[model samples]
Target: MGKFIDLTAADGFVFPAYVAEPAGKPKAAVVVLQEIFGVNSHIQQVTDRFAAQGYLAVAPATFHRVKPGVDMGYDEAGMKEGIALKAAVNGLPAPGVLTDIQAAIDHAAKASGGKVGIIGFCWGGFLAWRAACLLKGLSAAVPYYGGGMTAPAEIALQPKCPVLAHFSDRDH
Candidate 1:
């Protein structure tokens, strides 16, 4: 019931993205990065929330790099497949994902008429932080419960925009 759109990365990799537009002229744009679940219902709802806040929101399907349609739930089989995909993605350098994020950023910028922000959950949370670093045009970022970020000292220095990161001590 939401809007679906397409984006082509610098290397000619095309993928689908979920987008939500604000009522009037957008005050800003937000790139909503999904959890490992892909752009499911929850992710779509979250993007809609950003749209309600007067920001054009978009959530790109990051898994398209590994497979054209890779969405998984938290069930046992889904967990297994998600883990496998994560392992395969580890072989790809960070720059590769960064390229995809850049594509999303560009799309949002054009769609929102310039100003942009980013937000993400779980695995996408780490990506939001990375986008804050790699995507220079972003105005802000919010990352929720991204694991393994603290261990990497390099990421601490790369974020170019204001970042608001939230983590649950009990969960992550």
Candidate 2:
């Protein structure tokens, strides 16, 4: 089973995060941002994959701020619920979700011996891109099918570090 840890954000809020470590020295620390679903099995599997690739991996439950312990599957109903939760949190002003993302990156760095990267899926994908912009120590960022990122002018500029974004035509 993957390891679980409690991470405290900058604002003194606590959240659950899944972590996976490689056998040898890590090439870098990777913070895995979850899909609309919380840090569920799929996200954990992805974290494990990063660990297998020689990176220390951590996937933070971003929605833990609004509602803790919200892990959901990839079903239609799950999608609706996840979307609702996303809307509630995403609608917040600047420095809201960014606060959580920064905290995740810092926590992973401390746990993984410093160097850090980020990756995100679906809604988390947008967060990944934004994290690259907001966080200072990021080495790289990968965002996949990040919905609703196209219109955010502030987060649309070139990232502070290297970033690779994957988008599906059907998602937009």
CA lDDT, every prediction? 0.82, 0.85
**lDDT by residue (tens digit), candidate 2, 21-94:** 98888888999999888989889999998899888898888887778888898889888999899988887776
**Model 1: per-residue Cα lDDT over 51-133, one tens digit each:** 89888999998877886667666677876776676566656876776777899999999988978888988888888887887
lDDT of 1: 0.82
Q: All predictions: root-mean-square deviation over Cα?
A: 1.8, 1.8
Q: Lowest-lDDT window of 10 residues in candidate 1?
A: 148-157
Highest lDDT, which number?
2
* Best candidate (score: TM-score): 2
The CA lDDT at 156 in model 2 is 59
- Model 2: which residue pairs collide? none
lDDT of 2: 0.85
Q: For every model shown, what is its TM-score relative to the native structure?
A: 0.90, 0.92
